[model samples]
Target chain A: MREEPSQQIDRRAIRVWQLNGVVTTLVFAIITATLYIVKGQYNWPDFVSYITYGLAALTSIYLLVAIFVVPYIKWRRWRYQIYPHEIYVQRGLIIITRTVVPISRVQHVDTEQGPFLRAFKLSTVSVSTAATTHQIPALPVEEAEQLRDDIARLAGVDDDDE
Target chain B: MMNEMRHVHKLTIILYVFQGIKASAWSLIVLLFLGAGSDLNQLLNLPFTSFQLTLIILGVFLLVLIVFSWLRWYRMTYQLVNDSITIKHGVFIRHDRTIHKRRIHSINFTQSIFHQVFNLTEVQIETAGSDLEVDAVLKAIPYQEAVALKEKFLNLTNTHLVEEELPIDGEVEAVDEEQVEEEQPIIKEKKISIYHLLIAGATTGRVGAIFGIVFLLLSEIDNFLSEGDYERVVDWVSAQSIVAYFSLVFLYLLIVIIIGMIGYVNRYGRFSITRESEMLYIERGLIEKKSLSIPVSRIQAVLFKQNLFRMPFSLGAVSVELAGGEKDDKEAMQTVIFPLLRKKEWANFLKELLPEYQEDLSEMNHIPRKSFTFKALRMTIIYFVGLGVVHYFYSELVLVKLGVYLFALLGLYLLHRIPAFRRSGEQLVMQYFQVVMLSKEVAIVKKKDIQALETQGSRLARRLKLGYLNLSIMNNFLGRQFTLGFLSEEQLEEISEWYISGHHD
Candidate 1:
């Protein structure tokens, strides 16, 4: 018996990316404190804060690359099974929520890229229904376009004119 | 033709001026009060001369603007032809809005006491778009002409023209236009009456009066306590003695009954709903009589509401949710339909108004009995928890407050199981969806207007193989929330299938 793909979404991975959040906070705090010290407003107690900040900075650098960069690289290897009946998209570290959009209710599909995403040559695909909008962010530009076209074709909305 | 265009009453400008004056006076009073209460008098302070000058300038500007507005309003004209209604107005930027007859959803006529006295009516033409209201004051258009224009627009002859012209492949159009006309349905509609209006007034107007009285009593209680002398208060209380209280209560009840009567009389005074070949014609209202004609195809949803109070009287109101019109104000729903009907009459009335949904209604499954218990339990828990928290926090400030909370909890518990409910097949049907805390609504939503169907399952529900189904419809006035909870897995699947099939069909 073949287990449904829903099982994959229930699994968990250590979210090392959270350390990047801590590092980013530390970097911004250090920059602000350095500016304050240069202006002669820094206190010694506050100055000692940079020790924890330095530790966070070092750990975050490793965590960021391990979590974000590695995921982006490995995401290509990950496969999403899309069928006429259902679609399953899976990619996450800690918490995972697998969203299901029935094909019959799909109204329209859009592919867009931001500046950061453009630099990465990646795009986001958003599926819009009358009631709600769902998105799959940061796919390869070509793959995103293909997904959009496939979804549109499946939804019976002709994108040939566009 | 411009010269002959009927201007709104001259008093209309006077009414506007009065409104502006009232607004300005209230603002000045509030400012004075704030200035006196706070130490910010300097900010509001003005020398006598400056104050006089400011008032004079403001008054002059107000007067000039009022006169200009009146002139422009008086110059506004509207005309109804066979195909459309046209409104023309403007002082600086001339605006001529023409609404095709087919696009019109409803025509509303309003007559205030002043308008009634002047025998003038304000005609409001509602179309589908949000920003459009083609309104013009008809300076006494013969009631007959207004009725005739309404009838003309309600006739579906114009709608059929477009439908017939559309090309159909491999289909023989054997029927001549005359034969087709002959084959078109002629609906026999009932006329509203003084009695119906009385019933509407009794039910609707009495509720309004009760709320009004409660509001007045609450507002005046502070004044009665703080301002009145002891003797005066005693005198007032004495005036409300047992006999006096009973008499006053009786009189209030009588007044409510009268108002109900008046509401019915006003709304259904000359009510006549007729069908003229593929169109529904409704002529109603008293002082400012209105006539509306709606095409059969344009009907979006039909709703019928029955209240517990109205049940004994066998009075219900039916309203059609039509497409391509701005939603009426929330209060308008009360007087939107022919009011005060018996439950038995609903089936026949609905069949006459909407024959398409009759089969669907028969196939509807009743909400499971367990669902009501679950709903009741949920409501009870929410109410009790909320009550307990409030009492724990604000025990001192709340008045008769614990008793009130207990009473409210009791009321919710009772009403939760009032068997207020809904059922759906390939179509949507809901009964006693709450309108207010006290009132319930029953409506039939068409399948096409349903935008989406969502099935949600929580851990408990998933374990039990039960889920909640929500249907989102296009009508905003009806609100977007339609929850059917505690349905079995099979029921959920069936509901989804029904929703999908209905939409496609």
Candidate 2:
């Protein structure tokens, strides 16, 4: 039976993305504040002065959106599946993309997690082929392992070196 | 028995010199032209005789190439070990390469007109994973040695090598079958016709090469013939009428096209692709003979390419991609299965060669109106941006600028009407509309052969329920990626569902 890529990632990814977004917003705000302080010292150019104000407004809006909105949407959209003969991934914020990786061409499979993802018990499954690598990010650690093993078995790929 | 690494034929030195000059002439000419403004006069003004200086420079150039050639020749060596081929080469640093018999992509031999007279050929052995660093090349090997080497390579693999007969394994039943198969080894042969050559040459429009050369030479001449001393020469030439200059250009272009056509005909003259057992044998060239042996299993895909001019006539070239082979379209022709053919023949041709990929793609689903709207909005934004830039530069051409925008909007409308998709069992063909080239390019992929697929969306696109779909296949060096953007929600659902499942009979 035909269907869309059904499996979604661990919902903690939303919290992780929101936290990262907050950090980004903080960084942008700090830079803006520093620029305004510099502006306090001397008269900035007309264009530079205008840009500083615009950046200040944009970052504040970004901080609110990232902390409250974008993460939830990103989490809602992301999906992936490892079938008997293919791996499917559907993701994107503004443009939704659906991706498929056929098993026969798979060269290898890997499970990796960053320090942040590790704290949340999440892992990324990377499926490699002759062409490029596809990553299914933020799956539960056990699920990522299971998916990796399943893909390797289906693809019949031995752990040969690149 | 010990396997010994061997050097190629000594005559490779001559081949190297010929190749060195051919490769270096353009760069050397460019250097001369760039220097002609100041350096030539300064050299002429030197106390030494001009004749002596010229001879010294020529001597030095030849010495460099000769030394370089000697170093390369000395370093290059190949060894045919059990079930593998090892090559070692490099002037200062050593690159020792070992290619397994099973991994070999193709073994090709090239004999240029000069090598033809000398009865020497260059054998190039390429593997599935070759890249920039190492290319296995035997510069010049004698015909008999080359043939023997090819047989040895094939014998090691113990596959269906049709060109050479090997003793069957000790089974009487198998021997009888093998004997019967040996008598019917030749699969097919296709020769390019002169009529096909003319259509391809005229449609290709490669005569622009002359225009490129002439324009470069013209500017160089202008730079050197400035008002100080060459004023008389410039004036005498500047007296020509507009029509005369146009006629001269036309005449030159005509000559160039004729030359280009001749080159095309010579390169593809008597071209034929033959199959024997599991290997495809491509032999072509009028003045210089070249033959290639490629295993049918290694061919990743058959890719078709045609410009607008060729498309109307249903003529297109088809090349089979080999993993890790060169990607440039011009070099792609060297690996082309058929240089040109009518559209009607595509299905029949593919059915014969790759039966699984055969499909009827004459009709397809029309994209949702949202795709057109997305493109129109994007184009409008670009038009406005362009209008702003043009206005900033020359704001006075308001009517002309609007006219240009109007023309562009019409083109976008045309683009929206053309995209199509067709599926046949496990095979898929995407007729993607390329607005920049104003042509429709197609990608024919087997679902089981697909390597990866992806869907991406922007925040606005998600709100509008649209997305971009991209898929990759391992049939090429980088794995050919085919992508379609601004697909509607319904369309995205259809494609995403298609990818999530396997193609079953």
Candidate 3:
């Protein structure tokens, strides 16, 4: 059973991933720069003579492609099938992984907005079960709240024995 | 009898002083021994006349300090009001503390050999937090008052005598003083006698004590041999024939069994269990007396275990899992229920204690017959591979090692498949939830206690829509881990749903 308009998660998650990639690259750049400066003081070698510089360059390129391009493509292909009984999330880059969480087992659902996400007016939804926790990151704030209420209502009702 | 409550037996403080002196003496001796090889002779370089004087002066100083500490502690006193137990002590600090009866999860009373001789008891109340333990409520309260206070605290309904019941916002109305007095029962359940101690000792605690002794002996032997004399000992043993070796092994096992028996008898020398309306009380100990009471609702889980050796004796150990109970240093499993029982009596006892979980056993699911081949093959292969690695490393002794490998592999294969695993709908009805690892433990936890559930898929399982479900529960000290493995995806989902529904309810 599917809703009339196939439910699509907010596309802001792509931006969140892209931002994460940029922040990670900056952190590595600062660390590498410090090491290179330290090596120069010790007369070790130039930055180009170091193997780590080449590895860092490769990592930067990989992160750029993965963070921006991959998540965007996946988000385009992603489809969430949410029903009264269960919520199924399907998305992947190369190999698709589908997770089905039953509403009965949903212990609690939280809608969190970090400073960065709040600036973008986006919220992350986290659902905790007895044994696992799942997150749907960077949805529209309004949509995340709706999803939280719907899950809570579904969990509150006792329909299993039937 | 009332006089006993006011003054703690004089012997307790004396014993404390003695113990402190012993510890201090050991420390000084160790320091002196370590200093013997060092260039510290100058610091200790005293004239013979001065050395003798110094020794005498130091000894007197130590004695005075020990006596002072003992006297300060001796004056410490504690009393149990209707709702709270107050402890007041400390020579300089003058610390005064009170623990409410309602907040206390378990009350444990311990009497060491010295306390026992003086007819005194030490009571400890365990509360919810991790930071502090209320160790000395009444260090040497009269044994009878200790028992009465223990019973009073254990019975939740008799809260008026301990403390005025805190007013709930909207639920319980305050009761009058007359009603509170009427509720106090003069005679509580009689203190469990020494007989019950034997039963408890014969079961789990005794077995643990035996194992501890064996471990200690083994370590001592290792130490002695490692000191460069082991080669000589080994040469002497090697002079014996193969038959002699076998007999020596047999003798070792016999000695271990005898030690186990002694441990059991000593620990459970005087076991007793009495049930009040609100709690189950258990008291057992030989030289060191132990009394513990667990409330009915606070009991989280109950577990039963039966090893192959215990099968013949028709004996099993039943342990209760409760929150806020002191975890033993050795065993992580917190048992608040009956510690041991005959298998036949377990069903009746469990039903009496926890009627909510008692269910028809036939409805439970045993491990499917189809799963037997998988389990057997997996265990056998693991054993073979492990033995193969050992063999490869010690190829110089291949023949003898090969025989050992074969024997181990066969034994493991039989153990894995013979018993067969079983699970009831949501509740574990039988003693079958054991993981066949280094130490096998059977756990029976309520669905609500499960903290998290995870389903992992391999490449193949991902395709087949089948995966492994790992259920993590909060372990007292270890934080959280799981009794996890492969299961049918559908079954995993159903179990997850069941746990979720249970939590919501």
Candidate 4:
């Protein structure tokens, strides 16, 4: 088997993911509350009330897993490395995917940061080739910028038509 | 050398009129058939009778179309300035697009019957851009003038190639057509004979598709015809005797086959491929003559395809994925280089046409046999679980369950037998089946053209040492991925290693 990539994403990625999970859990909480409201307003059958209870239970379970479990495992699994000629990325929770993108084939590189990522002082480095784009997400802001610039410089050294 | 803007031939107006009618044909049909003679006529309270009203509407629509076409034809113009072509178009927006000769990938000339009547041809210029439309088009130009422009553009592109010092293959010399005009001999040529066209049409495997389309059209016809009329037509059909019914069935089959043959012959009647210098020229079509010129370097990948109907006869076709062109016109981007070639002749065909991809495909490594059982089990688990749920709802569908099971087994068997892969130096050859009918596709793509390589494995697959390999190549603005599943880890590792390091240990 090939060796695993040497680098991991920023440690703060877990917290960011948990924050996202909290927002999703909030949405689920609203849905469960709405179902409860509808059942009472319409004098719905016992089955409706039972469905609401089932949804509430599922939501609570999801809240615990998403905030407490999934992010950490996801962050732990994400690994990447920058070789002289190619970029190696391995990521996934259950179905692991390893991608190798040659620097020569790269069309461009970019650093992007959403509001949450910006709040955490993190950014995503997206390397685009002619056919596909691979992102190394949740890197420190400065590191992401440096990585983008490095990839851009390396990609410029080779020229070919798409 | 013409720097001044020039409009297309005046015939473009007439062509645009036909185009406008074609674009709004469905609305016209509804207006005429459903509205004119129906309650809509009384609701409108027009001065004339329904028949006169319909005539007036048709007349007004025709007049509008003629006026609009004239305006459009008058507004669009093209010019050649230095090494670039500029098209000034749009009836209101006045859009101007300039494409350099260096970016030109191919130029196609199409002569429709109308254009033939006027001794004009339509010139479509394609560039290596991500535009959904051909970069530029001269709707109608004198045939001789278009040919001269094509040569000039090709020569300019060749001059740019020389300046760039690209690694053109030694055999495919990028010579200046201007200098070699006297001695530009055809290096190789192939033509499809009438007998081959008959075979190609018979094995096209489009009969099922055509039957479906015909039935769909008949179903749509119910909307126009009243229920009584529809019943009468059905009764007339059912009223035939057994002998008449048999003859009717025979006639239908004959008509379907004849329709298929006519379509195939019309599209590829005089099909011919010619190679000269660094370009491959394809000329085909009967009613509408089409000729295309593609440079050798622009070919992204080569595909050998065998449909289910043709597989039994060992017949297949060769197609190539070009780097850039309009995707709306399916033929523009992925072109069939050869319409028909026997299995044994494939290597020879590739050697003669695309020598860079010529390789011994016989030595490919098949996927591990054990992986078949794993995949088949996975498919069965998912399908049967769904089937069991369906059985709970529709318990009497035992025959349906059997049919589904048999179909799934056949699919698994075909999937298990087909997949093969090989990595030879710069080229990676992958053979697999697609399109739900076990139509075999063998694709050869260069490593340099591949934008990314991905290997994926689920937990179960990881334990079994099986994985999937996907290679992405540029198709228009997006990447098109070709995937091979159930490959052993060793095969994946060796391929990935070769891709990453450009060599194997």
Give the best candidate by TM-score.
4
DockQ of each: 0.12, 0.40, 0.13, 0.63
In model 2, what lDDT does residue B8 have?
Answer: 78
The candidate 2 chain B region of ten consecutive residues with least summed lDDT is: B155-164
Fnat of the models, one by one?
0.08, 0.71, 0.12, 0.92
Task: State the lDDT of candidate 1 residue by residue for A79-120, as single tens digits.
Answer: 345666445444333322234455555678899876556666
Model 2 DockQ class: acceptable
lDDT of model 3 at position B318: 65
> Deviation in angstroms for B123 in model 4?
0.7
Output the better candidate (2/3) by lDDT: 2
Task: Flag regions of model 1 displaced more than 4 Å.
Answer: A1-162, B1-62, B74-121, B132-156, B159-185, B205-210, B213-230, B236-269, B311-314, B327-329, B332-335, B359-364, B369-426, B435-437, B476-479, B502-505
Better of 1 and 3 by TM-score: 1
Q: Pick by DockQ: which candidate is best?
A: 4
Candidate 3 segments exceeding 4 Å error: A1-162, B1-32, B36-40, B48-68, B71-82, B89-95, B130-137, B156-245, B307-315, B336-345, B369-443, B448-459, B462-466, B469-485, B502-505
Score residue B432 of candidate 2 by CA lDDT.
Answer: 73
lDDT of 4 at B71: 94
User: After TM-score superposition, what is the CA distance of residue A65 in candidate 4 from its true location, in Å?
Assistant: 5.0
Error of 4 at B504 (Å): 12
State the displacement of the C-alpha of residue B225, model 3, in Å, after optimal TM-score superposition. Answer: 12
lDDT tens digits by residue: candidate 1, B357-421: 55333334545555545555766778679868987987785657657766766774555443323
State residue B372's C-alpha deviation in candidate 4, in Å. Answer: 0.8
lDDT of 2 at B291: 83
